[model samples]
Target: MDVSSIAVVGIVLLIFGYGLFKRTDVSDAFCEGAKDGVKTAFELLPTLCYLMLAISMLRASGALEALVRAVSPLTEKIGFPAEVLPLAILRPVSGSGALSLLEDILNRFGADSFVGRTASVLMASTETTFYTVAVYFGAVKAKKPRKALAASLAGDLSAFMLSALAVRLIFG
Candidate 1:
């Protein structure tokens, strides 16, 4: 196994040993934690399902493609490929959707192509902003997340622009 795997194992063992030393009921503690996790998962399930359904509808209805086409002019002028615009837009909302789009880009433009490299960099740079905010804020029961959502979307835009620029500078 890799060093990181070994480190994780060591950490787990250390925590277990510490619990034993403290005379804590480790098994009961673990069970309680697992129950809490299950409760949280149930709480988040509806949100997750809604997100997946929305993504599917967006793709199936061709709304995503229309949005890409609508932004093509500006993207083309900014040196960003119109083809990867969908990936950039989806990256902030859904990781799996963006990943599928990335795979399509890699397949269509060859992994070694400039577009492919930019997409790869973009995938690394950005986060699933909406999904993360939904899950985390939902977990914490935060009702007002406007400021956090705005900040996360802004960061995602910056990462998208920088990824495109960096790929161009490095590869060209």
Candidate 2:
């Protein structure tokens, strides 16, 4: 097998070996972990559903394209590609949405082009902010995440704003 497979097997063996050495019931521990995973999944389900619905509505209503067009002039002056603005706007809300946008950008612009490279860098550097906040805060049942949300958005903004410059510097 490959090194990765062997490494995974080694890690699994180490965990069980340690459990055996400590006189712990590994199977029971595994069952407990599985149960907790299921619990966490159920806890986060509602938040996920709400997020998906919001994302769908935003896309279906053509609001996303309007926003992109509205911001195009200003973003173009700042060295950001207009084509990538959609990905930037969607990145914070949804990973899958951002990914689809990225794929389109790459396919349309060609990966060797500036737009593709900037989109690639931006995608790698940024997080799915709302989705993250939803899952984490929803899991903990925290109602107020204003500060966290603000900070995360700021980080995404920085990434979006600088991605093109970074690609120019790196690839130019």
Candidate 3:
């Protein structure tokens, strides 16, 4: 119907056609990609464990609770749902920690509910924060990613703002 919709259809048709005619190395390529993904996962497991442990420690220390309370007033002013305040605070530092909070919220409140819908949108658009940034840049051995990091982090902030607004508008 729309130009973008037509473009997507065209791309899918082209891919299908190419698969029918070309010397396809799909299996080999797919296997290689899977292998690379497995390798990356293995390499990152230790880093992931350390991050989770540190985040757990922060949660245990009560500092995270205090931090959430401290920012609650400001986020309240900006229209963030009170229910999402904990996930919002945890999102920037650790993805697993944030997801645990998000999952609990989603389980307690249905996905169609304001808090769950907000979490869904926020999770989709935002990065996994420090872990992703560190691993991606470190993998590439990038020295200075000032501009790139700014752009990525700016998008995360925009997602947070837009998701909050969307939740209020759709379910408030």
Candidate 4:
């Protein structure tokens, strides 16, 4: 097997050996952890589903396209490729939607081209901001998310602008 495969096997063996040395019930511990994980996932399921449905509805309503048109001129002037703006806009809201837009951008502009590279960088740099906020904040049962949402969006905007700049500086 390859080095990575061997390394994974080695790690698992090491963990098992350590558990034996410690006289711990590693299987029971693992089962308990898995049970807790399932519980957490179940707790977050409704919130994530609601957020995803809302995002899908917004996209289907053409609001995404209209927002892109409204923002395109300013982004273009700033040297950001307007072609990837839809990815930028959707990325903060929905990862699947952003990934779909990224595929379109890469297909429309060949993957090695400037716009594609910029989108690649942007996709790498930014987070699924709303989804993260929904999951983490919701997990903690935080009643108000205004501050977290604002901070995450600010981070996303910075990443979006810098992704284009980084590609231009690196590839040009």
Model 2: lDDT of residue 30: 97
Candidate 1's C-alpha runs over 4 A off are 1-70
Cα TM-score per model: 0.61, 0.61, 0.58, 0.61
Q: Model 2, range 47-164, lDDT digits (tens) per residue?
A: 6666657656776798866887888899889989887887887789777667666766788789889989999999999988998987788878568999999999989888988999
For model 2, state the Cα shift of residue 107 in Å: 0.8
Candidate order by decreasing lDDT: 2, 1, 4, 3
lDDT of 1 by residue, 67-135 (tens): 878988999888897778888877887776676678767887888898899999999888889888888
| lDDT accuracy of residue 70 in candidate 1 | 91
> For model 4, how does the per-residue alpha-carbon lDDT over 67-89 read when each residue is reduced to its tens digit?
87888898889999777887887
Please give the CA lDDT of all the candidate structures: 0.83, 0.84, 0.75, 0.83
Off by over 4 Å in 2: 1-70
| Candidate 4 clash pair list | none
Q: Output the worst ten-in-a-row residue range by lDDT, candidate 3.
A: 96-105
Q: After superposition, how far is residue 21 of candidate 2 from its true place, in Å?
A: 22
RMSD to the hidden true structure, all candidates? 7.0, 7.2, 5.5, 6.8
